[model samples]
Target chain A: MTDVPESSRTLPKNSGIQEIRLGFTLQHWCLWQSKETPFGEFWPGGEVLPYNGGRADVSFFPMMQSRRLSPLARAVSAVAWHSRQQCGDIPSVFLSSHGESQYYFEILQGMAGGEGVSPSRFSLCVHNAIAGLSSIHNASYQPYLSLAGGTEGMFAAFLEAGGILLETSKVLVVWYEQALPDAYQAYLATSETTFALSMILTRGGGPGHQLRLARRPGKGGSNAEDCTTSLVQTILEGRRSAVCHLEQSIWQWSLDDA
Target chain B: MKNLEAELKQLIIDTLELEGVNPKDIASDAPLFSGGLGLDSIDALELGVALKKKYHIHIDTNSAELANYFASIKTLAGFVVSQQNKSTL
Candidate 1:
C-alpha cells in the first residue's frame, strides 16, 4: 500500500457531500460457486446471462465474447452501467492493468510485420477510453481521470478517487480488468477472468455505512477478479449495499435483497 | 415519399434505441425531442455525434437551430442530404 499524501487525506465538506452508492458486475464463472450469485441475485436480477451464445443480455459479456473491447472498455462499461443506475450524472475515474492488450499485441505484430498500426486501435489503446466513453454516455463534461499500475492498479485508482472525493463532495471510482487473450496471456501471466467494481463516495454520512482509512499489513494481494468480487461481497454483507475502499481494492455490494 | 419517411423513421429508431417504437408508428413531422419520440438531451447529443461521424455532416448545437434540425426523422435526413450535397459542391 502506497502512502496517501497528507494533502489528500482529508475530505472537504463544503462541496455538498453525497451518499455513495456502489454496484458491480462480474463474470458468471466467478460467482457460480458462491452461496449467492452477486449480480444475478442483486440488481438487474434474473437468470445468469451467457457471454456469447445465449438469449439473455449479459451486461458486459459482449465485450468478452466478441473480443471487441480492450480491457479498458470492459472497465468503462461497468462504471457506465453503474453510473446510469445510480445518480445518472457523476464524474468517474477508471483503473486498469493491461489496457487494450489485444490492440497493443496487434500493434506490436504489425510493427514486426512492417505494417503500421491502425489509427482507430491506436487511439482506443489509451488507458482513458473508459473515462472518455463515460463522458459521452452521460452527456457530461465533468472532468475524468485514468490510472494504470502493474499489480497496484486498483490501489492507485482508489487513492486518486478518494482524493477527489475529499476535494469535491462526490466521486465515482471504477476498477476493471480482463484476462489477456491466449497469445499474450502467458506474458501478462493473468487468469482468464473479467471483473468490474464501482464505488460512489460522498461527504455526507450515511446510515449503517462508514469508510475507514486504515492499513492492516503487507500489501493486500489476491486475484484481481476475486479482489473485485470480495469487495462487493463485503459491502453488501451489512446493508443492501455500500461502497468499500480498502488500501488494496474498491468494491460495492448489496446487503438487502434486490 | 412515405417510404422515405419510413426509412428515416427506422434509422432514428435503430440509432436512438427507442424501445417499442416501430417505423410505421412515427408521424413524419412530429418533433423528436419533447414530442412523439421522447428523445432527451443526451439522445440529441448522441444523435448529433453519430450523424457527424456516420454521415460526415456537422449539426450545429445552438438552441435556436436545434429545434429545426431535430424536428423529425425527415428533417434530420433532409439536413444530412443537404449537407452531403454541400460537401460535394
Candidate 2:
C-alpha cells in the first residue's frame, strides 16, 4: 500500500492505434445472487462457486434509510459493505448495464395508469440512486463514479478502477444488475436473475490476486459467456486467462503472476 | 382527531418506507422532521404527496405555515381535518 504507481501506467504508448493493457490487484471480493442457488447452476458449463440468496444484510443503515433501497440497491450495498469492512473506505466505481430497469418500469407503469408517481419512487429511480444511497449510508464522502457501459460495462468499470488506482491506494468496484423487465426481454439477451459482485482493486502489488486486462483490435469468440459469473470463477480458480469478445474488440483477462 | 392521527402515522410509515416501525411507536406530539423521527426534506415531500393522494388535500408548498403544518402527526391530522371540513362546507 505504501507504493504508488505512475498515472501513466495505463496510458496507451502508441497514442494512435494499438492494444491497451491495464493491471491491478484484487484485494477483497464478495458476490451475492438473488436466487438461493448460484446462477451457474441454472446455466450449465459455467459453474462457479455456490452463493447464497437471502436478504442483504444492510442493518448498517437505520430502518428509515435502509427502507428506500430497492432489491438491486440492497444487493449492491450488501457487497459494498462487506468489502468496506475488509478494505476500509475508498472511492467507488459502480457499473450496471441496466441500472434499476425494473424500478423504472414500475414508475412508467404508474404514470401510464394515471396513478401519479410516488415521490419516493421517483427520487430513487435514477441510474446512480443505488450508488448514492450506498455512499451516504457508508458515510463515505469519497469520489464515486456510476456508469452504464452496456455489454462492456464490466470491462469499462475495471478500466475506471485501474485509472483510479494509479493515485489512490485502493478503489472499490461494484457491478450489479437486476432482471430486465419483461417488456424489454425480447429485444436483449440478459440474465433473468439479479446478481451483484464487488471487489477492491489496488495498484499492481496489493495483498491479493494480480490481474491484467489486455484489449486488442478484432472480434472475439462468437459464444457469449456470462461475464459476471465467468469473472468470479476465473479469479476464484486462479485461471491463467479468460477472454470476452465485444462488438469490435477482444478483451482478455489474465493472472499477472509475473 | 385521535383516529386521524393514527391514520396519518400509518401513511407516513408507508410513504416513507419506514420499515420495522409500528404506528404506535411514533409519538403523536413529537416532531416528525429533525426531531424524534429524524425525517428529512425528502420525507416531507413524500409525505405531502401521500397525504394529498389519500385525503384529497392540497398542501400549499410555499405557504408560511408549511413547516408548522408538517410539524408532527397531530398537526398533519388537524390539517387534513380542516381541509376536509372546508371542502364539505
Candidate 3:
C-alpha cells in the first residue's frame, strides 16, 4: 500500500472530451452465485464458476467463525473473502443494490409477528456489514467504501473505483445482489441478480490493453446501460469492453491499448 | 439428563450458527457464556427467545434469577424439567 502522489492519484473529472477517460488494469477476479441449494455446487459451461442456481462455497473464510451469515452474506462474502486473498490488503469499494432486502424482510416479518427480532439479522441489516466483514476477515485497517443506492450499483461502484485507482496502485471492487425473497418479487430490477463479482484493479496506463471508461455514445449517447450480470458475461467472453446505461448518461467501457 | 443436555447442545449450535462445532464438544456442566462457549450478548437474546418458544416457558432475560437457569446446559435442562413438572402438576 505505497502512497500515490496526491496530484496524480485520481482521474480528472472533466477532460474536455465527450468522455472523461480513466484507465485501470484488471488483475484477478472471483465470482459467486447462490440461488440454488447444496452450497458450492458448480454451474457448467460458463467462465464464471457459480451460476445463477449454484451455491457459493462458504468455507473461504474459515476464520469467519459463525456459519450464521445469511445466504446473501455467504454468497457476497465468499467472493469478497477470496478477492482479499488474491489482492492482498488493498483498499476496496463494495456496492450492492437491495442487498438489505433479504434480512430486512426477515426482521420486519418477525417484528410484525410479535416475535423478538433475531439479533444477528438486525446486526446484518446495515449495507456496510458486507464491507465491514471483508475488512475484518482480511485484517486490513483500510476503509472499504460502501455504496448502496439505485439499481445500478455495479456502474456506480466502478465510478468510485476509478476515482481511487487513479490515486492508488490497486483497488478491490465487489459488486453483488441477492435473490429477493419470494415475498418481494414485484420489486426486482432487470439488472439485479443473486450473484457477486470481485475484481482487483490496478491503476491504468501500462503495456497490455487495459479497461478505459467514458460517457457512452459520445455526447448524445442513448441512456442504455448493460445489466450487471450481462456485463460480466461480456467480460467473461474476453470482449473488448462493456457499456452500462445509467441515469441520464451511459457508461461506455472499452479496451485501451497502451 | 444426558439426553436433555444433548438436545440443548444441538439447539444452541443450530440456533446460534456455530459452524464446525459438535454437540459432543460441549461440556454439559460448563458455562454457556463468558469464557465457556464465548457467545455474546446478542446470542443470549436469541437463545432466550428460542428457549421460551421451545419449552413454552416464560424467560425474562432481565430477571434476577435468569442467570441460574442459563448458566450451563445442565442448569437449562433442570429448569425445563422443573417448569414442565409444575405445569403438569
After superposition on all CA atoms, what RMSD does each candidate show versus the true structure? Answer: 12.1, 6.5, 7.2
Ranking by lDDT: 2, 3, 1
Clash pairs (backbone) in predicted model 2:
none
**Tens digits of per-residue lDDT for model 1, A123-178:** 66777865676566566767888876544435556557666766765677766665
Q: Taking the tens digit of each residue's C-alpha lDDT, what string does model 3 give over B1-89?
A: 88888998999998998877899889998998888988877788888878777888766657798888888999999988888788888
Candidate 2 CAPRI-style tier: medium
Task: Kindly report which residue stretches of model 2 are placed more than 4 angstroms away from their true locations once superposed.
Answer: A1-17, A37-53, A220-226, A232-240, A256-258
lDDT measured at residue B55 in model 2 versus the true structure, 0 to 100: 88
lDDT of 2 at A76: 89
Q: Cα miss at B33, model 1 (Å)? A: 25
Q: List the residue pairs that clash in candidate 1.
A: A236-A253, A236-A254, A239-A255, A240-A254, A240-A255, A240-A256
Q: What TM-score would each prediction reach against the true structure?
A: 0.49, 0.85, 0.79
Model 1 accuracy (lDDT, Cα): 0.53
Tens-place lDDT digits, model 3, residues A119-172: 777878888987787677667987689887454436677788888866787898
DockQ ranking, best first: 2, 3, 1
Candidate 1's C-alpha runs over 4 A off are A1-75, A187-189, A216-226, A229-258, B1-89
